[model samples]
Target: MADDHGTSIERARQGRMTSEQIRRRMFDAALATTGTRGMTLGFPGLQMDDVIAAAGVSKSSVYRLWKSRDAFIGELLNEAAATFADQLSDDRALRTAIEIVASRPDLHATADGRRRLILELIRVVLEQNYYSTIDSAAWQSFLATSAALLADDGSESLRRVAETLRRGSDRFVEAMASFHEAMGRLLGFKLRDDFAGGFTLYAVLGSAIVEGLAVRHLSNPAVTDNFYLGPPTLTDEPTEWAPSAIGFLAIYDAFLVVDPDFDPRTIDAYLKELATATGADSVPPADA
Candidate 1:
């Protein structure tokens, strides 16, 4: 039976399987393995034999696809980095933000209420983004690549990884800036006159805070649970505020202020437009 099974496997490989198909299978298997066991610096932990076994491909097939182990690892890292960036769920986050705004009509009536609403949105969104990152293995791998920049190795592989990371970072920052700008306009806020960096800078700072906290959380998960009671101005009752939320709020306040000319009556219309734009109306409830 074992001999028969081996023969069938060999027969399947010799059939019409394409090179791209084989490479994809091996790449996926390697990612799954890295996800479970965690990645090591320089990817030394991802053995070729393990990938072949997991992918159920012959050794010769893999070598035919990638001339050397280094070549395979380099391509894998590049692919992983690109996937991580491509997977950023800004639409989902925007949908959630729309819901937060739509659910609280009373909050839109007054300045304080509007301020509180923005704070709540920031806290919830920050937590949501942070948790999502920690849950994703591809994201963790991409993040790990950041450390590779610290090494003095100027190899072509490292340069590709760095370029991919930069592109991803730029894409993230741009997406975030757009999101923040929309939310700020919806809530009758504008960047302060004294704020020179504008929304782009806001996005950059916000990204740093979330990523910094995420790295810390990896080492001490207790950081997630570490929150202080909110002051009375921000919440009616004492609310637990994560450090990241606090930092974000501080940045938000510094960067934005209430737009005096904003008409509160237009808020509903604004939200409706935002919901339509983000396709949030079709999005199911968070609990659902």
Candidate 2:
């Protein structure tokens, strides 16, 4: 009966596995399957069997950790929120430091140079938002999940999903504000108060517009060629995209600048830096 006793021991050991460990395994599986056709193509469409197969875990294990598909998605949204929070924290510090450097007299000796530096900082902030949203699979999935919830307006889940998305967007704005505040400290001016227009509105809308362009460009390269100002050959890589993006950002900023004396074109010099970052030909030639 030794073999039977060993089988009983094995069963008992399996039963004794910790819930946290099981959850971790299931969470990893869900993340692994995120970019696959089933996950990204549609939201809340993935079946229990799909997760079970992808996770390599038994149905009972998944049930124990997440009772249903909705429960699993809820957990995923929480994880995405936590991840974005960490990313925002890191970006806030880095952007602040960059703004401080940009504001330094020695680095930006001319008024034009300073203005350009500030504009570049704005692009960086937008890119940070882009990374947090489009570049992140978890965030994208969470967005899709939230959209699905909103579509089902009659459901009780809509409120929770809406709140989650609203909170996430609010945090994103607050993070952007921190960068603006840091820049303001250096320039001795507040963005919203000093700019004459609603800094908050422009900042939020500009970021959203840029993000939409990025997404559309990815989905259809032809859209960039037909609509954007520069060469129709614009690629999504930051290097190939510098000129058009910088020009667009300048146009957007023009409305935000209340001072008749303020000229958004001062940022032309900084656009070259974007080119340099993308390993493209810098404007005015690097040596000159």
Candidate 3:
């Protein structure tokens, strides 16, 4: 009969979705739900019925994939934590900052010029990171999960979360350290002898400042938008400096000192190499 044939076709279509496919759909739906509703300790707001509706999958399919709701949530959190490092390790902003420095050959000739270049790069990178962080729902959810886990008492889940956070933190620090090392080598600067932890500490502090500002910005956009007029430069009038820029510069000044042994002649070669590495086509020649 036609009715029987149609029912069989519908069943075949539903059967084509493998268990893995169903699980992936549920996972994506859960992340989207958490991102919109915000997560808390134990992910109390993440209901199975809600995820099932959003995923457009049957309750039977989801239940067949996991033993229970708690088991499903555990897997979801584990998967999220596993991906935390990759999600946070974006290098686009750093590459852009490098391009900005490479395009300004005139700034490399003088100590003051180089310092100004560094300041401008920091400001630009920080602003970019802030905007990127706030705009990403996944990043927001990760931050919230981290906060909740860190505030909880000792538990197996807390330990797992802490380890995951440490990995993400380490990746972020390494990215910043690479940025610092490259700038130091190119611009004739080095970590101060008295700075005990070197680039690692510097990276940690910088990340903390940006993360704190981002968290505050969620409640008050004005805090992130606030800027102050910096002192006049030799060739230009005063310019507006963001709060993060001022904070970062203060730390930069305290932690870094000019390298007395650096050779100015090698700057061109360094810039060329840097431009190639960052895939930048607009870097001006050293003489220009």
Candidate 4:
């Protein structure tokens, strides 16, 4: 009896450890799934079976852990929110520094920090397509889940889920809005000025950047070739994407062009800083 009890405890401990690892891998796999596949196809096309395969976990284990695909994704978003907390703190520091620059307009004292912050954000923009795409899916899912509650066949359980999703969507949007506002401030103006009908220029521009990259990356070679009328290639390497970054900088340049007082050199300096840090401006050697 004593031996059996000891054996049971050991098994239980191993089971617990396995469960913990499964949960962690599932979270990571969810991120991977959403990052590559979701960027191209969007979340609506995301299937649970593919997620299980990508995660390398059994469907039984996944269901035991998250109960359903939506529940798994919800937890993934929660994990992302927790991660964003750290980024939020960084944004706060950058915002405070930028506001100081705005008041005093000192390029030398604050330029390094500003450039570093822009590099951080630009890295996120380039590498983490999931950040923007997931928010869009979450918002859509929130509304759909909420609307389902009004149906005659609605269940109380689903309503609860919808409420949770609603809260998640709200937090996600708030975080994104804060980031957008910070970027706008860095540009020395609001992205959604009265002339723009209250629609955020940053959001539109960000979406365009994401879509363009996704097309170049996730689409068939023929599709890209059709657009370019030849073979088209786009690099995923962070260090080799200066041209794309330059394209983004041009939008900021246009904004600065309109403002006679705001110096374009400030932005040019920041882009140079980013290019140096990313090695995006490096030229390949000839006769390699």
The candidate scoring highest on lDDT is 1
For every model shown, what is its TM-score relative to the native structure?
A: 0.85, 0.59, 0.83, 0.35
As for candidate 3, its clashing pairs are none
Per-residue C-alpha lDDT of model 4 across residues 154-263, encoded as one tens digit per residue: 54445455455446544544554455554544443433233452324444564466446534543443432222111111222233333334445445434422222444
Q: What are the clashing pairs of model 2?
A: none
Candidate No. with top TM-score: 1
lDDT of each: 0.78, 0.51, 0.75, 0.45
TM-score of 4: 0.35
State residue 193's C-alpha deviation in candidate 1, in Å.
2.2
As a TM-score, model 2 comes out at 0.59
lDDT of 3 at 284: 65
lDDT of 3 by residue, 1-288 (tens): 999998788667667889988888888888776654444556777789988888877778788888899888877775666554457766786577667776777778877777777777777777777677777665776786687575667766667877887787788789888887888888788998878897988888887777788888888988786888874433477877777766777788889988888876677888778778877664666777
In model 4, where do residues sit more than 4 Å from their true spots? 7-153, 195-288
Q: How does model 3 fare in lDDT?
A: 0.75
lDDT tens digits by residue: candidate 2, 114-198: 5544555555454455444555554555445544554665644456556666777777666655545445444333344445545
In candidate 2, which residue ranges exceed 4 Å CA deviation? Answer: 1-14, 17-24, 35-58, 64-110, 123-134, 192-202, 225-288
Model 1: worst 10 consecutive residues (lDDT sum): 279-288
- All candidates in order of lDDT, best leading: 1, 3, 2, 4
